[model samples]
Target: MTKTVLVTGGNRGIGLAIAKGLIANDRRVIIGARDLASGMEAAETIGAEAVELDVSDRQSIQRCAEYIGPVDILVNNAGVLYDRRVLQNPGDFDVSMATMVHGPFYLIQQFEDHMRKNNFGRIVNMSSEWGSFSEGLLGPNAYGIAKAALNAMTKALSAQLPNNVKINSACPGWVRTGMGGFTAPRSPEEGADTPIWLATLPDDGPTGGFFRDREPLGW
Candidate 1:
């Protein structure tokens, strides 16, 4: 049977790239966008299903869980990077945590049981090198802190989840997405490479690990 994959923040950039790639691989792909209209447009254009999902909102996550059907793979690619650090915009920290850390946990809670029942699942948490303590948590406005928490979440849940239910964190590197900007050397497709790989990991694949370019990354 074909697997279904959900890619959050799939209206643009790396998320969109992952969605498109998964569809090309014969997976039933669903793209989640914060705006319903935008999501529908992108889905129609790309041949993937669309859902209105603002991961920061628990109600939105709940609604999606009700309507999106069973998802075999989940790509938690939704995130925001604040231009200013906490000193300039403390609110950025909250938004960062809500979108990247808390939201993903809520999503896992909603989906993990279904995944377990089916005895197969894959979860890809989009993280960053900045999330690594080894790298000094360098992202601005709690971006690194949020991703670090996300990475920690991956590790914590992995310990208890069934062996077939794999979860891992991926860093897309300096890609030229809207967030990464045009000056970045890598393209969105390049950024998506590792995330897509993680999303499609085999039953025996490594779990609760950090990776970039499909190689292990230090926590």
Candidate 2:
């Protein structure tokens, strides 16, 4: 059976790569983006449906959920990175957190019931290695903090999910994207591998884990 998959921020970057990967596997994919034109164009390219979704906006998320309906796989790949330091301007921190953490958290809560009822689901939260407090790397304060919170949210949701449902976080590493900039080592295709792996995991796969390149990574 073709699984229903939804990838947020699918118009570009890692999200777009993941969408293409799923499409190649013949999954029923939907590309969600903040821009309708870009989203539709991406969807057309990947043979997927397009839905308008701005992770920071609750109304947009609601509309996308209503349009896509229940999906077998949900990829929370939308994120924002603030280049400023914590002391630079604390207000920007809230904005980053709202998009990176709160947005995905609320969407997970909203779609969780559908997963529960279906008794089968896969949720892959896009996280970052910079979020690893254990690693002691703290450049982008807002981005790091938000991704750490996102990882925690993934763990919490995994615990609440039924045996048939699985939720995990994937760290795409330093990929060359608009957010990652041109200096990053990995390509979007390489960055997307871990997310696609987690999304298409078997029923027996691990949950509540943080991974990169299909291998568990330090939180």
Candidate 3:
């Protein structure tokens, strides 16, 4: 059976690559983007369905869930990055937090019922290496803090599910994308591997773990 997969912010970047990888694996892919036009174009290119979704908006997330019923896989790939350090401007912190933390939390809540009823699901949160408290990075403080919160959510949800579902976080290292910019070392294709792996995990796979390139990393 073809699994129903939903990837938020999948119109471009690592999300797009992971969506394409799922398509190649014969899964029914749904690409969620804030822009309908771009989302539709991307879905057309990848043979997936497109749904309008702005992760920062709870209503949009609900609408997307209603549009794509009973998703077997949820890839929370929508995140924002503000290049300001924590002390630089405290005002902009909410913007990063809303997208990276609150948005994915809402999405997971909206789909939890479906997952529980189906008795099988995978939840993959696209986190970042900077989110690791051990990483000790200083820049993009808001983004890192929000993602760290997301990682915490991953662990919480994993515990709650305990059976019939797996929840994990994937850190797609700095990849060359519109968000990652040209100076980044890795390509989108390389960055997508980890998320794709988490999204397609088997029943025995690890949950509540942070991973990169298919290997668990220190949190």
Candidate 4:
């Protein structure tokens, strides 16, 4: 049987590419977008389903869970990196954490039971090397902090998840997407590669680890 996968922020950018790649690989994909219209449009183009999902909103998350009814794979690929950092716009910190950290946490929680029941699941939390403390947390202050927290959550949750339901964090690198900007060296297809790989990991695949291009990286 084909597994069902949900990619948040799947209307565009890295998320969109990931959705497409998975579909090509024969997984049943559901594209989650904050905007229903654009998400449906994207889904049509890719021959997948689309749902209105604002990761920061618990109601939206629950609604998505109800609609999809038991996602075998989840890609917490939704995130925000406002030009304004916490220092520049302190409120932006809340927005950043809500979308990147808190949102994914709740998403995992919402799907935990369903995934557990199936005894098979895959979760890939999109992260960034910019969030790497080993690298000195050199990215935009808020984005860096938010991603670090996400990495922490990935490790913490792995301990509680079923062995068959693996969760791992992935840094897609600098992909040329709306978030990465036009000058970025990597293409969307290239950026989606790692997340796609992690989502389809075999039973022996590693979990609770941070990786880039399929290689382990310091968190």
Error of 2 at 151 (Å): 0.8
State how far residue 170 of model 1 sits from its true place (Å): 0.3
**CA lDDT, every model vs. true structure:** 0.91, 0.87, 0.87, 0.92
Scored against the true structure, residue 16 in model 1 reaches a CA lDDT of 92
Query: Cα miss at 177, model 3 (Å)?
Result: 0.4
Any residue pairs clashing in model 2, and if so which? Answer: none
lDDT of 3 by residue, 85-126 (tens): 767788668877788888988988888787888778899999
Instruction: In angstroms, give how far residue 203 of model 4 lies from its true place.
Output: 0.8
Worst 10 residues of 3 by lDDT: 132-141
Candidate 2 per-residue lDDT over residues 35-150, each given as its tens digit:
98999998898788989899888888888888888888989998888787777889778878878888887788778787888878898999988888767646387888888888
Residue-level lDDT of model 4, residues 1-219, one tens digit each, is: 899999999999999999999999999999999999999999999899999999999899989898888889999999888766478798889888999999998888888787899889999999999999887887797899999999999999899998999999999999998899999999999999999999999999998899999999898
Query: Candidate 2 vs candidate 3: which has greater TM-score?
Result: 2
Residue 168 in candidate 4, Cα distance off native in Å: 0.4
Candidate 4, which ten residues in sequence have the lowest lDDT sum? 79-88
Q: Model 4: runs farther than 4 Å from truth? A: none
Query: Can you give the lDDT of residue 15 in candidate 2?
Result: 96
Best lDDT among the predictions, by candidate number: 4
